[model samples]
Target chain A: MDYVLTTNALCKNYRHFKALNGFSMHVPKGAIYGFVGKNGAGKTTLIRLICGLQEPTAGDYTLYGINNTDKKIKDSRRRIGAVVETPSIYLNMTAEENLKEQYRILGLPSFADIPELLKLVGLEDTGRKKAKNFSLGMRQRLGIAIALCGDPDFLVLDEPINGLDPQGIIEVRELILKLNRQKQITVLISSHILDELSRLATHYGFIDKGRLVKEISARDLENACRKCIRLEVSDMKVFTRVMDSLRLEYHVLSDTQADIFTKETITRLVLSLAKEGCEVLSLTERDESLESYYVSLIGGTEHE
Target chain B: MNKLLSANFTRLKKDVFLKLCIIFMFAIGALLPVLDYHVMITYEFPRYIDESFFSYTSFMVILFSAFCSLFIGTEYSDGTIRNKLIVGHKRMDIYLSNLTACIIAGVIMCIAYLIPYLLTGIPLLGFFIVDNISTIWIFLGCNLVLLIALAAIFTLVSMLNQNKALSAVICILGLFVLLMLGAMIEDGLNQPEYFEDYAYMDPETKELVIEPSTANPYYIRGTQRQIYEFLSDFLPGSQIIRLSAMDAPSPEILAMYSGIIAVATTSLGIFFFGKEDIK
Candidate 1:
């Protein structure tokens, strides 16, 4: 797989506390990789280490094939833009002024792309409004705009939708989607809001207790948490017989309940059960959500 | 580094606090001479225009420190420093760029005070009253060195602190403490070696009374005096106090000390800042 970012046994220790312990993951190129973890589960720690905000205690990572220990890693970082934990921006400057300042920091040649980047982030009209006076969402968008100063190909956002109103969250969500889809910019978004993350992420890295528990593509995750038909029948033996004859995949929950993995026609199911002397009591179509799949995979609730 | 310096300069141009501080210094510059002019006209007292103008060095230290603190503190408060690091600029470059910007700011502030004072004082009072033109130039040079050293010290304090308000307080308080120490040392160094004796008619005794002379307490007589004199020359604060009198005989040594202070503080500041896990 073509990965824009890859980590190998990356570790970060803060005195006695290990923030990231042997954590590893991959963010494929052009993929909006969702970094899923509970609070303090090393999601932000990994982001910080990667963004050069903090150093890792041991091991290393590569960005655009440049190793972290290499001096040229700084050059590699030119391809990355990150808003870690909070939006790193100058609050005293207006949105336009802030972008211009970031351009200056990045040593960009001109201010020509300022308006376009602002427009892309839906902040083109925030003229003359200093970032301190901006709403939380506006500030978040402005932070993203600052990160996009040099037109970086890879973006890393630490809790991008955090503390946003519903409207704000939707706006940010749409913006991330647009950036991924239209611009083909790869993104590494660390967020605990799995439901929202599920909507945007083409890949996921589930982290727990400073380690990566799993790394799964959206397609595989969907398959593992796919839709199923739940059935309640009069007899388990007859239902098993009917399922076996029909060659359908299922999980038996109780003596009388079974969940069929395939999408079978209701009439055909009933007929097949009837011929096997199985009386159908009730059936309900259900799909395993990302949240439930995560809970089941990690053997705990999201709150954990 | 050039880009960072230019960016800082851009910010400095728009900084309202800096602008206000410069304006305040200019006001003091213009007003002090005007007040001296009033004193000269009304009381017919002899006054030196150059002295009145150069006296601003004392207050300019505090003003310069306060401005540098606010200017550098804003980076931490606004998380703008992270922006530079994120863009691949070295930490050393950021620290030095800020130091350079603050140095430039300090110079501008001094000029703001100097220009008005020179324009008003040279015409109102006289051209030079220190006897020698070189003495006046040496004093100006001493003030410049002291300003750079002060800028470096304030930058170290301000950048090391993550809290803006706390850094501001530390920068101002630090300058005030140094100023007080400098004044104390300068006062001690000015003490006379001997005390005078007096004989007078006692009011109560109705006879002549004699009081014996004792050594001046503030006067130094040993190696402690050497240490004090070295400190007076070495410290930027003491240098400012001494230069205010326009009698810095070895202004070159003071400039060297200032250079050392600037280099030492800047090196330490950059090292510490490089280790800082910028949030």
Candidate 2:
């Protein structure tokens, strides 16, 4: 498969703190790759390095098959647009003025596209409003517009929806989806909001403690996170033995609760457990969520 | 000031402080000369530091340096350096953009100091100078030294610190250090002490040559009739052009002073500052 980004044994260290340790991932072409990690898991650091803001302490990363140290890497970067953490907009400049500045930064031929780009980000009517006075959501949209100045096909957004209200979040989400689908731009987004991430991700890369825990496509992830029977019983040991006798795959969630990963014969199974003198207090079936899948994959506590 | 400079120039245009600083320097620079004219009409003279480029330029340079450092250094401590790189600008371009602003700020301040000095100090010359051309050269020489020294020292301070308050304090201290160090270098080198002259010391292998008298190397032969002191050799801090203007500095010595302080320090600043990582 064609990949937009590939990192091998990438590492970065700040004094005694190891921000990214041997991190590696393959971001496929034309995919909305969701970079899921807890805060301070080196998400921003990796973005910074890939963006050329810093040099990696060890290993390397490649963009569009061009190695970072190669002459073509600079050319490759021109095809990328990124909003790392916060918006990079010049606060004192107006939105149009900011876009003009970005055009110069990218060495573009003209500022003629400023109107269309601003309209795309919903800022076309914001005549002469300096970015400093912009609302957070407006500023964020302007930031996205700034990133889109060079018409780059690859976009990197770090926590783009963070610190926004629900309506603002939806606005950003719809914009990103439209860009990916209509404009055909590949995107790499990092956010702690799993549900929001799941809504837009075509593929997933789970990171923890400076290492990539897993990388799964959306369809495969949906299949892996299945609808299972959640049973609250009096004795988990007896329930476990019964489940083992049934030859079913299950996991004990707590002292009195467990999950049975099967869709068939639920009534029959409960009767069987009752016959075996196991008291089933409450039995319910539900679909697994992205949060639960992430927890189970990394073996965190029962309550997220 | 053309489009080729547009790359770095846009960065400055967005920054209000830099813009305001330029206006501030111009207003003050334009006024100092006029103010000095008023002082001169009463037959009064300012102190060497106030009147000399070293004192006046040093003061303004320290101020300009603080402004530049805060404007540039805040980005580093705040992690905004990453955003600039992500926008596709190389480290070198970012460095150059900032350094241009610093040098430009220095030039503005230099212009500020010169206007008033020429408008006022020129008339009070009272026959000390033989011609207008010589007086202009003297002003040019002093102005070059002032801009060069201040730009170098301020660039160094900006690179070292990121906090606005701390950087300002450090820049202020840097000026003091520059003056003190220049004094130390002058004092230690000009004292003509001989190693073999001490009775307790053994003979020396190197030739033991001594000058006859103790005055600055610049003070060659002095007479009461002269308007200012005459020197045999150039002293680094000694004024190349005095207000009295009776004795004009030779072209060779003027070039040497301008080259040593202005050219040397400015280039060194550009070299180091060009390579500095904004973060």
lDDT for A101 (candidate 1): 85
Model 1 DockQ, alpha carbons vs. true complex: 0.63
Model 2 Cα displacement at A79 (Å)?
Answer: 1.1
How accurately is candidate 2 docked according to DockQ? 0.21
TM-score of 2: 0.73
Against the native complex, each candidate's DockQ, computed on alpha carbons, is 0.63, 0.21
Q: After superposition, how far is residue B239 of candidate 2 from its true place, in Å?
A: 9.3
Taking the tens digit of each residue's C-alpha lDDT, what string does model 1 give over A1-304? 7888899999888889988999888889999999988898899889878888778889899999999899999998888888987888788889999888888888888999888999988998988888889999999999999998888999999999999999999999999999989989999999999889999999999988899999999998887687988889999998887888889998898998988998789999999889878899999888888887777667665445
Clashing pairs in 2: B29-B112, B33-B116, B217-B233, B218-B231, B218-B232, B219-B231, B220-B231, B220-B232
| Model 2: residue A117 alpha-carbon error in angstroms | 1.5
True contacts kept of 2: 0.29
Candidate 1 chain A: worst-modelled 10 consecutive residues by lDDT: A295-304
lDDT at A287, model 1: 80
